[model samples]
Target: MSIEVGSKLQGKVTGITKFGAFVELPGGSTGLVHISEVADNYVKDINEYLTVGDQVTVKVINVEKDGKIGLSIKKAKDNPKPSSNRRKSNTHSKGNQDRTETFEAKMNRFLKDSEDRLATLRKHTESKRGGRGAKKG
Candidate 1:
């Protein structure tokens, strides 16, 4: 089978490097699967995911004009349905109980929080600035 962009093919890992892994595809063609394309999450070391002679399914992401092939292992796998257990963050929703609180009370709370944040920021910036060439250590 010819290797084309978006095609999923089985390949045998021939080498592994810090950056990526080399896989030998069908018809004796080789492709490089970059570290970033190796997994869905961060990949610090390619050895953790792949090893020499390991068989992996890879997706053809690109074919350079110079005949270089870019492959991806993560994209080759079927995408799993999104989990229902994901935590949906409602950052702005103060909730039904907070609705009972008086508008004045909410305003006061916000103002207090804002003032406290401003004070902390001022302190941090002043410490860093050190005010008028204050003793470089």
Candidate 2:
């Protein structure tokens, strides 16, 4: 089968590297599945997810003019299916929700947090400076 952009196919993992996995498509063509395209979550190590001789379904993201095929396994499995009950609602209503905060309350909270952080940073800097000053004394 000819590989085209957006074409989904099953391929075998021929090799694995730090950057990506080499997959051999049906038409004796090889494609590279980048590390980001291996899974939905962050893949620290590609070997942890796939190894040589593992068969997986991948989508052809790009078939360059120079015959370079870019494959993706994450994009192919990103959207499984949408449920009818999970559809977004259009109704809008205003209920008893506290959206107002007094100026004094806001300032007090902000000042308290800022002061705590500043105190911690000052203590750290002073300790470093004090150590140097003691050596001179």
Candidate 3:
């Protein structure tokens, strides 16, 4: 019943908040499972994933000297699912060498694109003449 760092334990959700959920562990000790530790993917709402009285298996990531315990639900899983909700970068590839651009080349392209966008914006704003002279009624 003793909670230690790196130990996995089942706990009950005592309270839920925007930041994290308070879990009541064995031996009447409580731990805070941060929103980020609640899931492998982005947790926009902790309530959506956990609620008061919900049972969860958490891994003890840390037990602070001040008696604060940090727990992680994602690490407690035997096989965690990879988070695919994140946007994948199209600029780089592991096996595709042909599409890879050098750092200098990429910087040059970015600068050129930025310059072009600024030039286009300037041309657009300059062509405008105060929206028909403020539309005098």
Candidate 4:
């Protein structure tokens, strides 16, 4: 059976490498599952996720002109659950601070900060030069 992009198929892991896993598709054709496409989280080791001869459902990501296929095991799975421990906090309380600043005020603040930084850099360079003028030979 020929595989097309976006097609999902059941395959068996034929080989595993540090970079990826090789899967044997239905028609005896083999495809590569890149390390990054293995899962939603960071995969430091491919062995942590798969092994040779393991059955997996993969999605066809690409089909090269040379008949090479690229697959994704991550996309074939459903959406992953979000970590409950990582909740966002609103630091700016509703009544504690102004909700918005005027465009002019924002621009003025940015310009002031930039000028201060430039002044500090200029002072640093001048100090490095020992406040000495160029010698007139």
Candidate 5:
């Protein structure tokens, strides 16, 4: 089988490492599956998802001129898990049935949150430094 970019194929997991996994392609070509490509969510450990000698479907995402191949196991899956950042509609609100936040409102909330975080960080830093401009008694 011709191993080209975007080509999907079944490969065996020959090795697993902290960064990624190595898969042996049909034509004896090996490819590296980066940790980010292992799944849709953050992959703290690759061993949690893949093991040596496991048959996994992979997509050929890149092929270097030096015979290096890059694969993605997440893309090979039919239905990947949705990102955690996608927020669901707020159904608990009783007053606003069809109310949607405007750009200005969202920006206001973001700014407020950022300000709060910065204040907290500044407070912590000041406390650690024994208060700003305080002369040691």
Candidate 6:
């Protein structure tokens, strides 16, 4: 009921929107669960995963001073990795790390890949145009 960060609580889907879903918490406080936090996979349609009046468990990711709460449905689920094994794996993580991709990480990776692809495309097309700064004879 305190609505502290990292707290998992049962909530009801009060409303759904293009961007996210509104969940009513136990204390009657509502929070927005962004579409990206809806699942581990890409969610083009939030309605497919949630609907009004559906019960859901959410994790309190953030609580703003202005009374805004950020919830995450996927994060509310327990991590499959065992703590002891996870710690051991961390020690050898440099060999082959399998980390969960956060939203920011995915965004940065997408931008980087897009820029690389555009650069390659420009280089390819420039050659067809007789290289840079060339004019018609």
> Over the stretch 1-137, how does candidate 4's per-residue lDDT look in tens digits?
76899999999999999899999999899999999999877799999999999999999999999989999998898674333211111214323433356778768868999999999998888778875464346
Which candidate number maximizes TM-score?
A: 5
State every prediction's TM-score relative to the real structure: 0.63, 0.64, 0.66, 0.60, 0.78, 0.62
Pairs of colliding residues, candidate 2:
none
CA RMSD of each candidate after superposition: 7.8, 8.8, 5.9, 7.4, 4.5, 8.2
Q: Looking at candidate 6, what is the lDDT of residue 125?
A: 95
Stretches of candidate 4 exceeding 4 Å from the true structure: 80-137
Model 4 poorest ten-residue lDDT run: 82-91
How would the candidate models be sorted by TM-score, starting from the highest? 5, 3, 2, 1, 6, 4
Q: Rate the local accuracy (lDDT) of all candidates.
A: 0.84, 0.83, 0.85, 0.84, 0.87, 0.88
lDDT of 5 by residue, 1-137 (tens): 67889888999999999999999999898999999999877799899999999999999999999889999999898876555323323434334533467888878878999999999999999999888777566
Model 6 CA lDDT for position 9:
96
Q: In candidate 6, which residue ranges exceed 4 Å CA deviation?
A: 80-135
In terms of lDDT, model 1 sits at 0.84
Number of clashing pairs per prediction, in order:
0, 0, 0, 0, 0, 0
Candidate 3 C-alpha lDDT tens digits along 6-122: 999999999998899999999999999999999878789898899899999999999999999999999999987654323233434324444546889778878999999999987
Indicate the TM-score of model 5. Answer: 0.78
Q: By the lDDT metric, which is better: model 3 or model 6? A: 6
